[model samples]
Target: MSEALASLLTALADDELILGHRHSEWTGFAPHIEEDVAFSSIAQDEIGHAAALYSLLAQRSGGDADGLALGRDAAAYRHAVLCERPNRDWAYTLARHWVYDTADAIRLEALHDTADEDLRALVTKMSREERYHLIHADAWIERVAAGPVEGRMKLEDGLKEAFEEALGLFEPIEHEEKAVHEGYLPLPSSELARRFRELAANKLDELGVQTEIYSRSDEAAEFVASSSGDLIASGDEHAESQPERARGLGGRSGHHSDEFQDLWDVMTSTYRNNPGATW
Candidate 1:
């Protein structure tokens, strides 16, 4: 595979894998039994999608899919920081789910015309399942919006918190320009980001939710990922940095929040303990 294609695949797969793990965290703890089952099923689908993407990467890159998915170090993951965040509350979880699925749908739609036949076919397959996930997220979003004032407020707060970090979902990967130039990605990350913002705004407007979530200034270029997976200001030549400051930043470059280490440890424990073991 070309470097650009490999990077793109790795980013996509990592996002799915990490977010699926987060979704699975709600398996037993969801507010109700129906939600518990729903989230678990969604988690399974996401992880399955990750596995399929990794399998495609393995085929072209001569690597093991399991190894690619389970054996990578924390800093080696290319997921958006949003995916690795802890699900703090039902409202926040639903908010993040809606934003992510919306962006993911845009991404998959754009990939339908990719130059690579294999990738286009895989995208088509994934989109079939992803449609239901989008519906689930959209329904919950509308439900929360139409419910009690407190629930609506909390959901809005979640959107405010999640929207900025969600932008990292469209952060460019290494050699992304080449990928676009080659028709592997018909649209660039900037274009995708624009579409995400527009789509999100329209949806929120239609639902009578706050649409000011996109008003934040662009700070994406102000931070760089440190060696320890922390995000530090690019201009902070002499300033001390901490892992706690890593939110909403540096994910495309493999930088992650402190929470990622905990997630990584649990997610990879079995693979680390018994290398090459398979069920």
Candidate 2:
């Protein structure tokens, strides 16, 4: 596998893993029985996707799939901050679902035509599952944003709080330009980011929610700061730097937030305790 392919796969796998955990955290806590069952299924699919991706990535990483997935410290995980963030409320979780599904849809679309045959096949398989995930997200976003006043307030607050960290989901991979040039990715990361912003903003607008979108000129420069690592967003990146961004960064660069460490420890504790044990 190309180095770029490996790096991209690692980041993608971590995103799924952490987001799966977050979704699963709501398994019993979802607002209603129907939602509880629905979200639990979604959580299962996400975790399965992560495991499958990790298995493929292990071939290039030269490690056991389980070990690769289980042994990583919080700082070593390449998930976006949005995924690792502790869930605050149902609206917040739903907002994250909206942001993540939008980005993941584009990411998978870009990878569908990858130069690597194996990756292309895996992405193709994942795409079918993600279609349903997108539907789920769309339904929830409409429900929350178009619901009661409290629901509207929560959705608005959630978007404002999460909008910046969600940008972290599109953090550039090393040699990302090379990948696009070489036909590994469908388009430039900037284009995908633009699509995400437009979709999110348009959705919010349809619901009568006011959202400030980034100007076309602010695209590349705002998303990736030179001083920060390719995967890390600088602390200075906020709504002022662009539009709807936040100050926190560091997930794509593998430097997770402080809250992530506890979540990581809990998630890995069972596997760590019995590395060789099997179900």
**Candidate 1 local Cα displacement, residue 52, angstroms:** 0.2
lDDT of each: 0.85, 0.76
Q: Compose the digit string of candidate 2's lDDT tens values, residues 132-160.
A: 99999898878776788888888878876
Question: Candidate 1: which stretches are off by over 4 Å?
Answer: 217-247
Among these predictions, the greatest lDDT belongs to 1
Model 2 misplaced stretches (Cα beyond 4 Å): 213-221, 225-248
Highest TM-score model number: 1
TM-score, one value per model: 0.89, 0.88
Give the CA lDDT, 0 to 100, for residue 90 in model 1: 91
Error of 2 at 23 (Å): 0.5
